[model samples]
Target: MEPATPLMNDETETLSRMTPVEAFLATPASNVRSETPQDPEHQYLWRCFPDHVWSQRVRDTSSWVWDFGYDIQNLNGSRRWVCKRCIQNKSPRPRSFAEKGIQNANAHLFKGHGIWAPAEATKSAAQRKAEKMKTKDQRSIADVMKLDTRLPREQEIANSLVKSFDRKHFQRLLLEWIIEENHSFSICEQGRLRQIFEYLNPLVKITDASITRKTIRHRILSAYESHKGKVIAALKQSSGLIHVSFDGWKSGNRHSLYGIACFFRDENSQPRKLVLGVPELRTRHFGHNIAAEILDVLDAYGIQDRIGYFTLDNTESNNKAMEVIGGELGFVGSTRRGRCFGHTLNLSAKALLFGHNVEAFEEQRSDQLTYLLRSIQRSEFEMSSDPRIKARKPLDLIIDNDTRWLSQLYMIRRALTLRPFVEQLVLKHRQQWEQDNRSRRTGNLRKSAKEPQICLEENQLTTNDWDVLDHLARLLGFYEDAVKTLEGDGQQRRRKRGWVGSYGNVWEVIQGFEFLLEVLEDYKKLASEIPDAEHFRININLGWEKLNKYYSRLDETPIYYTALALHPAFRWGYFENEWKDNAEWVTKAKQMVREVWEREYRHLQIVRNSVADEPVAKRQRKYYNPFQAYCERTRTVSGCIVVGGWGQ
Candidate 1:
C-alpha cells in the first residue's frame, strides 16, 4: 500500500485537526486510497488504511494533479472514478429532516403527558355549565304578597271546615241516633271520626294513640260501673274464706305505714291473691279512718263473714285493728288473728341480739376477719403448692354479715371447720398487734412526759349496749340448744378427744347451752301454767330440734355445712311436715311419720359419715355397738324398736 494522505478541511485544521466524521472514518475501519468526484463541485478522496479504504469528496479540484495518473479535471466535472468498494462498505448518512418545530414539540409533549387533565377539565367544565343553568327569575310572581291578598278567603274556608265538623255536637247526635234506632255502634268506625277531626282541626290537639286507647277504656268502664247492682249479684254466687296478712314498718324516709295483702281460698280451696292495700294513717284519728277504709274495700268486694284468718306481724296497731273490727262488725266469731311465725322469729332475734352495739361490734370483727382471710387467700394463690393454705377460694372464706346473729354463728362454724388455717391467721394477727404495741413503747421512750388525755370522758356502757349484748347472748343460747338437740343420741357415738358439737365451741357454746336449757324450762313452765294460751306462746324447743337436724345434714356438703349450722330452719320444715302428718286424723298417719323419720335418719347418717374422721368413726362404732346389743337383748317394745327398753 502507498503512503496514506491525510484528509483536511478548514474547520478541521483549526480545531482538533480533524472533522468528527473524518476522525471516525479515518481511525482504523475506513480504508481510503485516492480522491474522485462524480459531481462537478465535489471530490472524493480515497485513503488506504489497514482494514479498509474510506472515501470523502472534496469540492475544489482544478490545479493540483499528483503522479497517481488520474485526470483531476475529468473527475471534477461530473465524471469521476469512485472507490466502489469503500462506497459499498460505508453506511448511508442520515438525512437532516425537520422534527416537530418548537411550538409543535411542546404541544405534542403536553398532549401525551395529560392523563389526569381530561378528568379534571371535564369536572370543572361540568360545574361551570351547571352554574349557568341555575339562573333564577328575580322579579317573579312569588315575590309578590299572595298570602296578604288571600288571608280573608282562607279564613272563611277554615271556618266553614270547622263548622261542618263540630265534633262534640256530632258525638251527641250520633249517640242519640243510636239510642232512638236501638242500634249497636262500632267504636272502630266512630272512633276514627274523632281521630280524623282532632288531626285536621287546628284548635284541637290529637291525643297520642296510647292515651286515646286508655281514655276510651276508662269511659267504657265508667259506663259499666253505673250498673254496679249487677256486679254485686254475681259476686254473691261465689263466696269463700278471705285471708288477710298485714305488716307495718318505718320506711327509709321515716314514713310509718302499713301494707296489707289480701288473699282468699276460693270454693275450690285454692288460694287467690286479691288487692294489696296501703292506707296512709296520719294521726291517731286517722287510725280509725284507715280501719273504715279497709272495711269499705272489703265490702266493695262483697266479703261478709267468711274471713278465716287475719295474719299480721306482732304490732300493737295491728292488734288494735283486729279488736276494733271484731267488736264493730258483730262477726267476732268469724274473725281469727294469728301472728306470722317467720316475721316473729326475725323480729325477736333482732330485738334480742342484733341491736346497734352488737351490730357495730360484729361489723368491726367482720372487717378484720375479711382483711386477714383475703391476705391468706392471696398468699395461698401465689404459693400454689403450699399445703398449709391450700387454694381455698376467697368466697369460701367470706362471711355473710348481713343477718342478725346468724352470720356470727356461720363464722364460728367456719372457724371450727377451717381451724388450722384460722389458727395461723390468728397467730399472725397477734404478732402484728405485738409489733404495734412495741412500736408505741419505743416512741414513748423518746418522750419525757406522758401524752395528755384527749378528753375527760371515760367510756361507759349504755343501756342499749347492755340490752344488745343480753339479746345476743339469748339468741346464741337458742342456737346452742339447737345444736345439742340435733346431736342428742348421736353425740355419744361420734364423740372424739378434740371434737366439739355446735354447742361445744370455745366462745358461745358452753354458756349458750346452759342459757338455752333454762329458757326451755321456762317455756315448759309457761306452757303448763297457761294451757289455753300455749299455742300463742313461741315454742323454741321445737325450733332447736329442727335446727339440729338441719346442721347435721349440712355436714355432708362442704359449701353448706356452715350455712346449715347457722340457719335454724333447715330441718324445721321436715320436722313440721312430719309433725303435721303425725297429727293428721288418718289411719296411715303413724306409718307416714315413721317413713319420714327413717328417711331423715338415713340422710343424717350420710352426713355423719362425711364429717367423721377415723377416731370419730371408731367412737361411733363403739357407742352404737351397745345400742345394737341392747336391741338384740330384748324383743320389740310396743311395736317400736326397743333400745334399752324405754317403752313399758
Candidate 2:
C-alpha cells in the first residue's frame, strides 16, 4: 500500500473536523533538508523517522503522529500531551509527568525508533517495525551534536549488570591501586564511598556482597595461585639454570622477613625475575631455621632442584645458612653458593672507613670541644644568645651510624663541608678563654673535675689530619662507583654491562676482583703525594688481602668459568687471556671447566658410561675434548648465536 499522503495547510485548518488517525495519515512527509546538516539541538521532531526517510517527512508530522496514540491539548496556546492509551500498549502508565517540551525529546525519539522499549511494554511486530524506522530518523538529527548523552546512560546500565560482574577485573584494579598508592583496607570501610558509588551508579551495588577488603584479598590470592602455576610451567619449559637471591631485614616489630627472589631465562629466551616469597620468621634466627624457611618456599614451588646459584650477602649468618642448605640439598660443590660481589665490596670499604678506631677519635674531639665551649661560657664570654652563632652553618658533624650502609661516606663528606664552622667555634672558645681568665683575680671561679678543660692543641685538626679525611673521601669514591655498577638494575646493565650490574655471572666477579687489586697497587705509588698516606696505604693493603681470599675461592667453583666459556664468542679464549700471566692457574681453570662438564652434563654422563668398557686412555682423550664437541653440537642443534661478547 502507498504511504499516507501529507496533510496540506487546508487539512491542518480542518484538523478539528477529523479523527486523530485521519489527521496523521494525511500529514505530509518533511521537505526538511538541513540548510546546514541538521542541528541536533533543534531536530527534536525529526527523530521519529529513519535516516532513509527523515528528510522526506514534514517537521510537523511528529505532532500529528503523537496525537494518534496520545491526547494532546492546547494549554494557553502551548501543547500539553499525555499518553492516555499507554496501558493498552502494555507499557507502564507512569504517574510521572513527561514535559511536552524538548527536555525529554531524545527519549521520546528513542522510543519512537523501537530501538528501546520501556521495561513494562510489549508491542506488535508492525508497531516495532514502525518504531525502528522512526528511531533511525532521530539518530540522523543527533549525529551533529557535540555530545550524545544517551550513549553513556545506556552503557552505564549495561555495565552495572549484576550477573556481568567480573571478579578478575576487580582484582586487577585492586592490585593496581595497592601497588600505585599503597592504599589500606580502610578505603573500603568509608561510608561516603558507598554514597559516592550510589550517586555515580545506583545499579552497581557496593555492599559487602560485591566489594570488601577480604574479598579483594581473596581475589588477589586466587590470582597469585594462577600466576604460580604459569611460572612453574615456564620454569619447567626453559632449559636455562635458575638463580636464587636472598635479601633479609628485620621489621620494626623485631620480626625477621626474608625476601627470596629468583631469576631465569624463559623458553623464548627472555630474562625474567620473579619474587617467590617473603615469609616472616617467627623461630629463633639460627642457621637451620633460616635454611628450613628457604627450603620450604623452594619445595612448595617445586623449584628446589632447579637452583643453579644461591646469591647472598657475605655474613657469618649467611655462611652458616649456606652450609645448612648445602648439607640438606647436596649443594656441596663451591659453585652452588654464590657470594654477592656487591656485598664484598661494601665490606672492604667499611673496613677502611670504620676499622681504624675512627669512632674513638670522633668521640674524643666532640668531648674536648664541648668542655672548652662550656668553660669559655662560664668565664663570662657568653655568646650562646648571639645571632651569628645561632645562624645556620653547613650541617654539623653527622656521626656515622654503623648499621647504615655508606654512613662513613656521608659522615666524611659532611665533616669536610663544616670544617670552617668547626674551626671558628674552636677559635672563639680559645681566644675568649684567654681574655676572660686574664682579668680574673688571684682566686679563680672553681669548676668541677667533670668539667675540666683540655688544651686546644690536643683537640685541634691539623693540616695533616684534614689531608687524611680528604684522601679517605677520594678512596671511598672508587668503591662507591663499584657498588653502584655491581648493584644497578638489569635495564641499565643491558645498555652498558660493565658500568651496570655486571656481576650477574662468575667471570665478571673474578674480573672485578683482579681490577681492584691492580688499582690498589697503583694507588700505593700515588698515596705518597698526600700527607699521612701510611694510614690509607695500610687500609688498601688490607682490602687487597681480603679480596684475594675470595678470589681464590672462585677456583673451586667451575660454573663461574663455565658461564663465561659457554658464550660462543668467548669460549675458552677469554679465560686464556685473563690468566695468561699465571700459567699454572690458567691450566687449572681449563681442567676445572672440563671437570664441571663431566659432572653436570646428563648426556655427557650417559655417553661416558656407555664408553666405560673401552680402553682407559682412549676414554680420557674423548673426555678431554668434550667441551669443544659439546659447543659445536649445541650450535648446530639450537642455532643459538652469541648476541654479544662476554660483558667487560
Candidate 3:
C-alpha cells in the first residue's frame, strides 16, 4: 500500500527551497568521529554501503532530525542527505537520499517510519512516481535525452552516445557494442541491427554495406582514432612512472590478442590501471616477437619513456621478452621484471596435482574422465543404485584451461565429489569383464570374440590417487586466503582509468615467496618420513622445487627488495633479522637496496614542516597531563631499538 502524500507546511517548504550546500553548511558537526574513530556502532555500514561516504555533520539543525539522518559527500563533490535510522534498522538500500535538499528525506522518514519532522509539504514516493510518469508520457525519447540530465561532468557522454538521428554516431556506437559484446563485426552491417536503428529513428538510415575483412579494418581504425587521443593524454599526465602488464588472450573466435595494460598514479596522485590495447598478434608467440608487439603498443600510447616495472606470469618466454624490452627501453630487463605472484602460486599447485610432467598428467586425467563418464551413462550400465533414475542424465565434466589454475583445482575437486558413482561404474565394468572371460573359458561365451572388453585399469582412478588429490586440495586451500588478500578488488577504478589503488604490491612478493618456501620445505620433509605417503613425496618435492626456483629468481630484480625496504612495517631491519642465520644473505640484500636507491631514487627530495610537528598526545583538551602526569612512573633505562620484527 502507498502512503499518502505529506502536506508541505511553511517550515518544510523553506527547507526544500534551501540549496543542498546551504543546508549542509547549516548542519552541525558530529563529535562521534573524533572521539571514536572506529565508529563501532556503524562499522558494518561500511560493508553494506561501500558506495556511501559517512559524513560528520548531522542534518536538520533546527529539530531532533539530527538523530535520524546524515550528510555525506557524493561522487560529484556535493552533500547528500541519507536517513540514519532507516539504515540502522538494517535496510539494505533505503530510498532516503535527498539530492537537491533535505525535503525528500524528511518526507520519507514521516511517510515510511512515522518519525516527526518538518515534512508537511514533502511528497511521497508514489506522488513522485506519478509526476515522473506524466512527464515521461508527454516527452519523446529524443526530447528526454536532450534534457540536461547529466551527472557532474558526466552527462554529456550520455547525450553524445546518440545524436537522436545522427547516422555516424549510431554506426560508431553499433560497432563498439558489437565488439565489446563479442559479437562479430558482420552484425553491424546486418539487417537486424539496421532494422532496430530504423525503428528508433526513421530519419536515420544505416549503411547497408556488407561487413567484410576490409570493412572490419576500416571500422576498427575509426574506433581507435576516436579513443586513442584520450589514452595518450592520460599517459602523458600520469604523475608516476607507467608500469606495464601484458599477457596473451584467445578470444571466442580463436583469434590471438595481446592484452596490454598500464599501471601508475594519475595527475591527481591516484592509482591508474588502464588497458592500452588488445590488438591481434599475427606473428609467432616468441619472446622477441612478443617484445616487438608490446613495444608497438607502448609507442602508440607514447609511454615508452615512462615505462616502469613489468608484472607477468611465470612464462619463460616472458623473461626473454622482458630482457629485450628492457634493453630497448634502457634498463636491465631482469631487474625491471617482476613475476605475477598469483600465477606462480597457481603453477606450484599444478605441480602438486600433476606429477613432474604436468601437461601429460593433465591430458590423461581429462581423457580418462570422459571415458569413465561415458561408460557409466551407457545403456549397459547404471550410474546409480536406483536404475529408474535413467543412465542418460546429463553430466558435465569441466576441463581446465591454460590461463586459469583455479579451474584446474575446481576440476579436481569436482572429480573427487563424484568418486562414488565413478567407483561403482568402474567396479561394474570390471565384474562384467571377468564374468565374460569366465564364460569363454568354460565354452559358454556370452558374446562373440570380436567384442572388446570395457574395463581398463589405466582409465580408473586408484584409491591412492584419490588420497593424493584430497591431500593436495587441503594443502592448497591455505593459499586461497593469500591470493584473495593480494587480489585487491579495485577493478572499477582501473576501468575508469582515472585512479587505481587497492591492488597487490611488489613489496609483499618476496616475503610471500619466502613464507611459501618454508611451508613447502617443511611439508616435504615431514611427509617423506610417513611410510604410507611415498607417492605423496614425489609430487610434493616437484611442487617445492618449482616454487623454490621462482623464489630464487626474485633475486634478479631489486625492485622487490626496494619495495620491501620502502615499507615502514618491514624495512631493512626485516631483512637483517629474517636472514640472521645467513650473514652474507643480509649483506647482499643491503647492497641491492643501495643500488636501487642510487640508480632511481637517490636525487628525490621532499620539503617538510619540521617546526610544526609535535609529539603525539591526547586528542581532546578535556584529558589531563597525558604523559606529564605519568612522568613519575617512568625512569631512564637503556634499551635496544626494536623495529621490523627485530630487537637486540
Pairs of residues clashing in candidate 3? 7-120, 7-121, 8-120, 8-121, 150-155, 271-500, 272-500
Q: Candidate 2, residues 29-112: lDDT per residue as tens digits?
A: 333334344433123222321222222222353433343233222333334333322322223232112235532432442343
Q: Please, what are the lDDT tens digits per residue for candidate 1 over residues 1-648?
A: 334545445323333532232222223212333324432112222322112222233544321111111212222233232222122322132111111222222222123211111211222333344334534312212122123325787556554554655444544454555546754444424567656744554333211111122223333444455655654443344445566666555655455566766655344333345434455444453335556656655666566554545655455666567766666555341225554433333333333333323355433245675678677767766778765547456534535454333455455455444545564666676555544544464543333433222111232333443333343344444543344432232121224454433322211222223234445456555445543433323434454443333223222222221222222322222223323555332223223334434543335533222443444333232213322332222222223221322111
RMSD of 3: 23.8
TM-score, structure 2 vs. true? 0.53
**TM-scores of the candidates in the order shown:** 0.32, 0.53, 0.59
lDDT of 1 at 505: 21
Instruction: List candidate 1 stretches off by more than 4 Å.
Output: 1-239, 284-293, 296-300, 333-335, 346-369, 381-392, 396-426, 434-648
Q: Which candidate ranks first by lDDT, i.e. highest?
A: 3
Question: Comparing 1 and 2 by TM-score, which wins?
Answer: 2
Rank the candidate models, highest TM-score first.
Answer: 3, 2, 1
Which ten residues in a row are the worst by lDDT in model 3?
Answer: 627-636
Query: Of the pair 1 and 3, which is ahead by lDDT?
Result: 3
Error of 3 at 399 (Å): 2.4
Q: Over the full model, what C-alpha lDDT does candidate 2 score relative to the true structure?
A: 0.56
**Better candidate by TM-score, 1 or 3:** 3
Stretches of model 3 off by over 4 angstroms after superposition: 1-173, 187-217, 249-256, 362-395, 428-454, 462-464, 492-500, 525-531, 607-648
